[model samples]
Target chain A: MSILVEISENLQRGKAKVVKELVQQAIDQGIPVEQILNEGLLSGMSIIGEKFKNNEVYVPEVLVAARAMNQGTQLLKPLMAAAGVKAVGKVCIGTVQGDLHDIGKNLVKMMLEGKGLEVVDLGTDVSAETFVNTAIEQNCQIICCSALLTTTMNVMEDVVKKATEAGIRDKVTIMIGGAPVSDDYCKKIGADIYTSDAASAADAAVNVCS
Target chain B: MIWTREQYIAHCNFEFTGREMFCELFGPLLQLEEEWRQQGASEKEIAMTAFDWDYVLKTGLPCRTGAVTGLKPIILEDTPDHTLSIDNMGRKSLLHKKAATIPLPLEYPVKTADDWLKIKHWYTFDESRIDYGAIESRKALRDKGYLTLFSFPGGFDEPRQLLGEEELCIAYYEDPELIQDMLETMADTAIKVMERVCDKVPLDNLCVHEDLAGKSGPLIGPAQVNEFVAPYYKKVWEAAKSFGAKIFSQDSDGNIEPVIDAFYDAGVNLFYPFEPAAGMDMVKTKQKYGKKFCIKGGIDKHVLRKEKEDIRKELEYKICDITKGGGTIFALDHRIPNGVSIENYRYYVNLGREMLGLPPIQGEGWQRMAF
Candidate 1:
């Protein structure tokens, strides 16, 4: 198999050791960094994302797979830097203001990063202003906000409003999610996208970026 | 001072006893802590801050109570700032400025087997920690013709929190023998804590808090519950019942309906914070169980963020309709969030009180769950 395909398979199986070894082997073989990344790590993550969305796999599986992918990416980082490979897109993410939950946000961030997006995690309890400012400063294409509580879920609307008020709404796509958020609520709040889970968030972000 | 089940239910004027009523005052988890920290509040202050309590009262719900299960302290060392430092299950580690500072315990008390060993030794059965101040305050309120209840703590998740989820899951699988070893250790530690607390305080009810589910369902299957959790629950339930406690309750989030029979068999008379997300239908569950269980906290947490009318409609549809002939407590399915405005919470609280026939609090609406 091609070195990229080998890495992708290892990642899909959540074989951290194999993923790292294959990534190093790919580097040793002098494959282009972006090609290795896109074909190997990102492709594996894309499959995992779909599996998760389709309920073929669950959170623990996704998390372990992400861990393997991250390990492989760690090995590819310097090579990618040397190749001057830029990220596919820059995305700013956080759990909305007043919410301390991070599992969902972290999952989304990891999946995004696995897909080769530059993820600027604003961390949990992020305010609308903070999201807007960070999106503007980071030149991000997407502002993804998460909330685990019903009360804190409303902050997604405030985030969208603040993004518009800051005149960056037109420049950035706002995606809101969490346990309590729905697509109807997303449209009601004027968000650009609403996904039920992390994989969907990743696919939507990637789709929007492309 | 003597109260029968009917009188107690009448006093609260709600069907369920231990359920929580939530008024969504805010949207999904916002950084209220950072906002508080930026406002120059101490970490203790930030942790103790209430979310939309005023609005919860305004809603006029019959019950108005919140539990403090997530206030445990964690000692973080060598963790970097900005990057999230979590324990194995991805729960955020507490950041304390000083080691000497005794912050409120927010998370689970146990972390590792070694940590559990250390805590087991250092764990004291201090009856004084039972928050008699709050109990006394409630007692006073009750004396003055207002109904009140105290929160219960410790359950299956408590041990899991101490042992970590991976270790516990593994213990259940590869090291079945170790499950007993760990459960014995946890049971002893918990028994001591319960004995200590019950000695000093007149507990309204003893609650066991265990979050045994994910979005899909319970983490452990039913057979595992029978093997690992049920025996320990029986022990704890018997201990609590022996101590003159009237209600022995278990608090678990998600659709715990699958194991409801096990819970009842284990002597848990009440279940709190019945998550609607997990498809816990009180009407159906009560019908199936047939007074074998007391239901609490079945209202969906999501409804709190809807408009006042929607909130009312759901209250009538989900809560009132289902709980009509059952032993039910009116409460939010989970914690009140900051996204719920003060006004909306009050409206819900008021509605809860009116429905349950509880006396009106001056500022709040109606009352209160999770594991």
Candidate 2:
């Protein structure tokens, strides 16, 4: 089998060490960096994302595969940069203000990255102004906001309002999610989108970016 | 309306009371206290009125069921809004004093087998860990007509304490042997502790907090739960049941419907705080599982944010039929969030209380029962 296929299969099995070694080996063999990324790393992650969507696999599988994908991608980062291979999309994501909960936020960020989006993680307890300013500064097309608390979800409305006040509401797609958010809430806040789970969020982001 | 322990036990087992047993299944969120104070109607006053009017109360038996007992959390850093602390499990967490959110786990203690080996000694049960006096006090607490429970962390929850949710999720696949060993050892310790507690005082309910699901479904589906979670539940629950514990209940915050059977089949008969926003159709759950399966909380909290009419519809949809034959307790799916008008909240409660045939919550001798 080709070395690229080895990286994909090893990453799927969560063999992080093996995947890292194979990614480096693929580089040494003069394999195109983009091929190793799209075919090797993202290919495996896309499958994991689909499995997660279908519940054929669970969180642990996705988590381990993400760890493996990270291992492989760390090797490809500078190479991809040198080749001038830009990300398909860029986004800034965070758990909204007054909410320290980040488990769901982090999971969504992973799924977003799995879809080949360059993510700027603003981390937990992030404010609306930060989400807006960072997205503009980083040239991001989408802004993702997450909150686990019902009380904290009010901040998501502020995120949309801030984006509108900053005159970028039409330019940036606002995506909202977390345990307390829903389709109705998305519509209520006038955000661009809301998906129930991380996999769907990633798919939605990719669709909007494309 | 003051049902004895006999009535509460009977109601849990699917016996119909004459009307809905007046109860609130979950506690108020501490984060909303400031809002409540601002509204000029504290839940404390509401709770006092609830009891004066014969509301059924619930509380837990104080039990130190952690891997290591008597180990206090050491504050690493203290700030105006948050405090960083490390516990016996060696996890570093940030506790927000002002925000009612849960402590965010920063650094996990157990990742690999070597880490498990290092912490294994803490889980061992000994005479020093036992508090016979506390057990006796629990018996007195139960005798006060509170729906008393002996609650502890479950298989998934205990390990989640050592490994944060993300790490624990990955560890299930990465380190099955370590997971199984930790669970089995914890179960052994749990069984040991429950055996002694049950021996001293008769058990009303034996509860294990799993918190193992989310908005989509259970974090792990039935197959993984069967392999990883249910076995320990089966063994430990059977031991507690053998000690005359009448109810084996599991507490999970999100949609547990997927693995509910796994827990039910493993001897757990009751569940709580079922979040309706997460798609836990409690009425459907009741129809599917029948009267033998018990539930505590299923009222949609989002309704409390809507019109008074919407609140009535949501409550009637949740409370009416499900409570008809018993095995159900009415409560908001989760905590009352900030911004729900005090008027709306009181309306929801008094309306529910009236539906249950309890006196209005307008305090002593006030006759605004149908406002």
Candidate 3:
């Protein structure tokens, strides 16, 4: 079987070890790094994301599959780097200021990374200044802010305002999400986008990045 | 006879007669500040503010119209400063710094057997920390009107916090003996703490806070709970009972149906904040547990943030359906997030009172209830 197909199968079954082994075999077999990534690991993750969106798989399953995909990616990273492969997009992400909750944020990050976005994670309790600065430093095309608390969600506006004040708002797309966050909130906050779930977020990120 | 807040709320509703009007109290945690910020709080920029204990004591209710206060040590330093970030899809992403403070057993606490031994000495019962004067004031306040003491830090999930999820999982198989020892130690400490606290204050009910489940299900399976959690809970419950505490309650977030039997077996007579995320149908739990258990806080926090009409509908559905048969108090399944407008919260509270047949919150006769 093709190495890409094997990697996809491993990911579907959540066999991290098998995925890792198969990726190594593919690399050893001289499969192009990008091909292995796109057709193998990324393809598998996309399927997992779809299943997650449909509720065919839940958090644990997603986490396990993500772990497997990550393992597979590890084998391909050096090869891809050597081949001068660039990330599909550069995205800056962080939990909004004053909010330290990260479970949802982490999941979204994993999914985004799985989708081949070069994510600049700003971590939890991120200040608006930090997000703006990171976006500039990373030359990011997208700025995503997460707030899990109603109190902290207000920071999304501040981050957007800061981006605007810095004259970087038009330069980058701003996205916000969390449990308390909604599309209405995103619109109200003047954010460019909002997604309720991680997979949707990843897909959205991919669309914007592309 | 000891009167619980549930009983008091019921009595004020005229569901019971002559039951004292003890107000329910929820302890504030530092985590709430982050939750509030995530919801878009703009007022306070500071972390680790103290909760207005005085305000809570004065009002006789857990409701407070001021800034929440609490101190939480940072646990993760290795992670970045941002709490939540969005991805390219405009989806918010979050990463908890490794430096973020975790519950003791779960993240920050004793990991190895040796670490346990070192920390064992710190667990000694400290009586001086017990504010007998405050307890006396609370009791006096109860006499004048009604007051309920907030729950302390004992619950099924507390030990898990101390044990850390990953290590605890490993300990279950790799080191059962150590796990048993840790549980025993926790039980001993819990019993001592309860005994000390109750000695100072006559508790109507003791709430044990633990988030045993997530949106999906319980963190630990039923068999593990039976083995690791039940015995320690029994110890705490027994200790509370000995001190004349009437209700031994647990506050766990998520659908706990899978472990409801374990809760009952552990002598947990009351359960609060039944999260609907795990498909928690309070009406079903009430039917299953019946009078054997008293439930509090089954209203969905998410729904409370909805439009008034929707909020009212949800309130009616939850309160009417869940409490229809009996043995339930209407409360938010969790803390009322800041996303829930104050107006909506008041609506919920007032609606709750109306449903319970309690007097209007603002009135001359309000002094009569004194809750």
Evaluate all candidate structures by whole-model CA lDDT and list the values in order. 0.63, 0.78, 0.64
RMSD of each: 9.5, 3.9, 9.5
What's the distance in Å from true for residue B350, model 2? 2.8
Model 2, B1-371: lDDT tens digits are 45566676787798876656545444456655566667787555444343333344455555556677446888999888888888656677887766655677777778778988888878877765567767767777677876666665578888887877888888877788888988888788777877777776666778788888788667777776888888888887788778777887777888787788778878888888788988898888888888867787788877887899999898778766655667886667666666677678778878888777666655531111100
Tens digits of per-residue lDDT, candidate 3, A66-151, equal 78888988777777878988899999889877666666677788789889999998887789999999999879999989875555
List candidate 2 segments past 4 Å from native.
A1-13, A17-33, A82-84, B31-63, B76-80, B87-90, B134-148, B357-371
For DockQ, the strongest prediction is 2
Which runs of model 3 end up more than 4 angstroms from their true locations? Answer: A1-22, A35-71, A83-86, A165-171, B1-117, B120-181, B187-206, B212-248, B253-269, B275-293, B300-311, B333-348, B361-371
- Which whole-number lDDT from 0 to 100 does residue B9 have in model 1? 40
Candidate 1 lDDT over B1-371, as tens digits, reads 12343345442334543333332222223444454455565543343323322211111111212222324433455443223235433345543222111121235444445554554533333443354445455444444443223333344565565555544554464456655655665556556655654454434455566777644345455566777778877776667666555666677776566667766787777787777765676767766766666776677666666699988886777555446543665466665444455456557767865665544554322123222
Which pairs clash (backbone N, Cα, C closer than 3 Å) in model 2?
none
True contacts kept of each: 0.04, 0.60, 0.06
Question: Which interface RMSD values do the candidates have, in the order shown?
Answer: 7.4, 1.8, 6.6
- DockQ scores of the candidates: 0.08, 0.58, 0.08
Residue-wise C-alpha lDDT for candidate 1, range A1-210, written one tens digit per residue? 788888888787777888999988888888888888899999998898887666565454566678788898888887777789988899999987767666678878988987789999988768889999999998999999998665567788898889888998789999987766778889998999988777878888989898
lDDT of 2 by residue, A49-131 (tens): 88778777777777889999999899999899898887889989999987887777787888888889999999999999999
Residue B62 in model 3: lDDT: 26
Give the candidate number with the greatest lDDT: 2
Off by over 4 Å in 1: A1-15, A22-61, A81-86, A149-155, A179-184, B1-120, B124-184, B192-206, B211-248, B252-269, B275-293, B300-312, B319-323, B334-371
